[model samples]
Target: MTSDTPEARSALRDSASRTLRLEQQAIAALVERLDAGFDRACELILACQGRVVVTGMGKSGHVAGKIAATLASTGTPAFFVHPGEASHGDLGMITPGDVVLALSNSGETAEVTALLPLLKRMKVPLISMTGRPASTLARHAEAHLDAGVEREACPLDLAPTASTTAALALGDALAVALLESRGFTAEDFALSHPGGSLGKRLLLRVGDLMHSGERLPRVALGSPLRDALLEITRQGLGFTCVVAPDGTLAGVYTDGDLRRTLDQHSDLSGLSVDAVMTRPGKRVSPETLAAEAVRLMEDHRISALAVVDEAGRPVGALHMHDLLASGVI
Candidate 1:
């Protein structure tokens, strides 16, 4: 088959489609296999006093690593230990309080199976995920999850294609179930992923990005429109917050408001800030998530928001620039 031949291209596309279909079917079958064993696996992890130690061999080992990461990030304390390394001293990492989750498509991978007796000796609960229910690993486990697939995507029926996909889907299902059972919030997930954008969305609060104290652009309600414009210029926020006599937010005056004011008349001396301000503008609490603040700004077609205290007084101000600079937008 020539690399650029039309027949070869067609075959390549067909092969990809067949592979996806096989994997999809494998995952669909796993959904029906969620039975008492699945529930028992969840129960064991939930009841575990120490972290979960996930181990597997070959392609199953790669899937095991991903599962361990997902479980760890989603509120379950988990880590992957290479099965081959377990016999070489990593077995000491497993304690009596820990739960061992072993993955193997055949359930007969020698490296993974060899650790069974030691795990049993440590009195650690063993949860096995495998395609064969009658395999050695499955027979020895306290709970056996059948991740069986009808066929491999490999044309030779020798590679771990559909089986590996089934195992990955099952691992995701387990992690999501454990997450729900633990009442894991996005904030909790962010605590484990502080360097990612998801962490920013969940952990970045309004107060963290807002201009507080003297940095906020503010003017008294009856202050001249000229004073408000000057305040906006001084703060470089494109807007100034209008405060009432008690220092509570009364309205917001923006460059857009300024344009409208200038178009109405050439006289700036007679107008008060309240006369040109957009009244009853949206306000957010200091504790609000920065993402929520961005949503509020987008929904209202406004570029700025006042951060107020419980008493409705302006404690800080936020602009689109601040959100953009903080990667909240």
Candidate 2:
């Protein structure tokens, strides 16, 4: 077999090196271009009464969708509407109160730029991100962000690489700036993501999951062991809470305790719950986060905890199943 000559290998290495170096230069160039127009874009979106509608064609379209998601998830109400779809029937989605964010490396993508007149006519503010400041898209936009890059990562500098990254980063910056200006909080984020882990952490409070009243398996401190077991079974929480006369949490009796107590005597009905209950049981407050409850349950290797009030009275109880069923786990 013929071996590659040193000259052939050197050419390949130089080509790869050039692509990497040019792409790095492109990113650096984009960093230098952030200015007043970028701030204008943020101001325009923040001033928008409706959602930010992001649109682009091809690679830019993919980035636009991601940017829209980031904006929606953070605080801004935004969604992606494809430029081609907008040309068809989706133009109706663009309202006068909405802000349109159009992305194009050349600022001349026919599919994206074709909707400019309609957007202008609807009186919707337009923010354009493009590599060419003199391009039609830039000149027509209410605010133009220069996402211009020095060169592509491709060896021939023909492919869309660094330009797309610059545009995506600019979109994120806009979303974050709007997020801060709106004073968006974690609760707002949870509202947008009701089914995700963030929602559980931020929105799912301990009171929402804790079993209360009769549903909370509870027995008086002096109750018989047999009666405590009955309460555990009827409540089906895997454990029964033992509270003092003043309603403060006194102790707990679990399924494991029943087994240990039963080994000594066949009849536990004569045994008082106070004599067998484990005192100072693991406890949490009604205001605690469900995520923190899960952590405590896992770290302590136990399920089912009594929820206490600020004054140390037993108000509720919670089990691992409660967290899983409530979508907080």
Candidate 3:
């Protein structure tokens, strides 16, 4: 049972603080220990034409799966396989051309060490992350990354804690080094994660959200003020493009313009949009990034803008609402 008493809360806070410090110390120690083995591990993964097969057991397995995901998303292709499952026909998932990354705190987990001979028979290079340098798995590996920690953060000193943090940090360092070596870019990462927010930021374009074709609201250069208002109301975009006779954009009339028109004239005179519209109104090319469009809109205090062609003709229109729907705002 947990308690909210002052003494209990103080004890809880102290435990959390100690755990965080131990985990941080574990991660910090890895920096000084990174050596030739780390380089060789990167070299093996970079040279492999096949996917990287990462395997571990228990808590190490959980960290191994996360490392594999980070590797695949960052440019290297990798996947996780359970050591127990690999001995049960999943070994077929690994190819001779692939490299294997095995993690075990003791470096002697029976299920993990059992696969060493098979890996050698297949002539596949092995990269092992372990706390024990003299253990079987570490001795068999082509490159041995020492992810050892001084001690577990657990009060009982038995559970995997600091050791797991060290392994995970080491894995991230290896993956990032490989990412830079391979010239991985944000666009490449976005391609692999098109459904994510980073992908939306890097891959989404203005044309993808801007209204085009029949949905686009536009009016000729000398169109009547009533026509522009009707187009705006019909499209519900708060604005309509005003085009010249030669099909070039002349200006834009918006709800703001309508309010101004009402303020300047009391009589319903023969007013055309050319008389009240904003001349050479703000616009962007269809190829502009949606993020850039957001900046332009915010900077100009605009709620709606036009997408123009190279010749300055209206091809599409963008509204702040579309950006909101697309999660760009």
Candidate 4:
């Protein structure tokens, strides 16, 4: 059998390292090119009354779709329209209130450039991201971002490797900048992504899911154990608050307490709720975030908690099931 030589290994390593270096150089070039033009592009998108229409061809099209999604999830409304599709009836989606962001390494993708005249006729602002600022698309754009790369990662420098990566990063930078400029909040992001976990974390508040008013499981301190059990069953929270006669949270009774009480006393009906209730129970305030409440419940190995007011009066109750049902946990 022939043995592998150090020369072959060294050559392969050098090629791989060179490709990375070229890509790094491409990204560095993009950073240097970021200036007033980038700012103008961001401002144009922010001022857009309609959505940001992103279009590209081939690999650039994939990046454009991702960029559009990032913009939509963050605060700016954007959507990707394939350049080929735009030549058809899809061009109707573009309006004067919208900003058109066209992506092409050569700045002259035939499919994308074909729509330029129509976009101009509609008076829609054009923002170009391309490797060649002197290309036709860049020359006609209101703002041109130089997404040029030093070279492709491919050995023959034929593929759109480094250039595409640089363009995608530049697109992300623009979207994030526009998001910040518009004062986009987490809640705003959640509103756009209502089905995602981030939306649950940001939009699910304590009050939104907490059990309130008469639905809250509560028993007066002097109430019998049977009454406490009835309260827990009626509320279906696995526990009940033990309130003092003056309407203050005195303690809590749970299934655990019932088991312990039943073990010590044969007749639970004769026992007072205070006699079986666990005193100084862990509680949460109405203002606490529902996610935080979930953490507290999990950490304590408990299923429910009373939401107490500043005066220590029980106003509401929350169960782990409530959080699970609301998609907060």
lDDT of 3 by residue, 1-329 (tens): 36788888999999999999999999999999999989899999999999999999999999999999999999999999999999999999999999999999999999999999999999999999999889889999999999999999998999999999899999999999999999999999989988787888788999999999999999999888889989999999999999899999999999998888899898645998899999989999999999899999999899999999999889999999998899877
Root-mean-square deviation of every model: 2.5, 4.3, 1.4, 4.1
Give the Å shift of residue 212 in candidate 3: 1.4
Candidate 1, TM-score vs. the true structure?
A: 0.89
Residue ranges of candidate 2 with Cα displaced over 4 Å: 1-25, 211-215, 230-236, 243-249, 255-270, 279-282, 285-287, 295-301, 308-316, 324-329
Report the C-alpha lDDT of model 2 over 17-117, residue by residue, as the tens digit: 87777667766776678898888998988888999999999999999999999999998889999999899999999888999999998999999989988
What is the C-alpha local distance difference test score of each model? 0.93, 0.88, 0.93, 0.88
- Between prediction 3 and prediction 4, the one with superior lDDT is 3
Separate clash counts for every candidate: 0, 0, 0, 0
Candidate No. with top lDDT: 3
Candidate 3 regions off by >4 Å?
none
Q: Could you give candidate 4's per-residue lDDT for residues 1-329 as a string of tens digits?
A: 22378888788789889888888888877877898889889889988999999999999999999999999888888999999988989999888899999999998899999998998899999999998989999999999888988778887888889988899889989988988898999889889887878888877777788889889999888898889999999988999999998888999999888889878998765788877789978799888878889899889998889889999999999888989998887
Q: Candidate 3 at 28: error in angstroms?
A: 1.8
Supply candidate 2's per-residue lDDT for 158. 81
Q: How do the residues 171-192 of candidate 1 rate in per-residue lDDT, one tens digit apiece?
A: 9999999999999998898999
C-alpha positional error of residue 241 in candidate 4 after TM-score superposition, expressed in Å: 2.7
Q: What C-alpha lDDT does candidate 2 achieve relative to the native structure?
A: 0.88
Worst 10 residues of 4 by lDDT: 1-10
Which residue pairs in model 3 clash with each other?
none
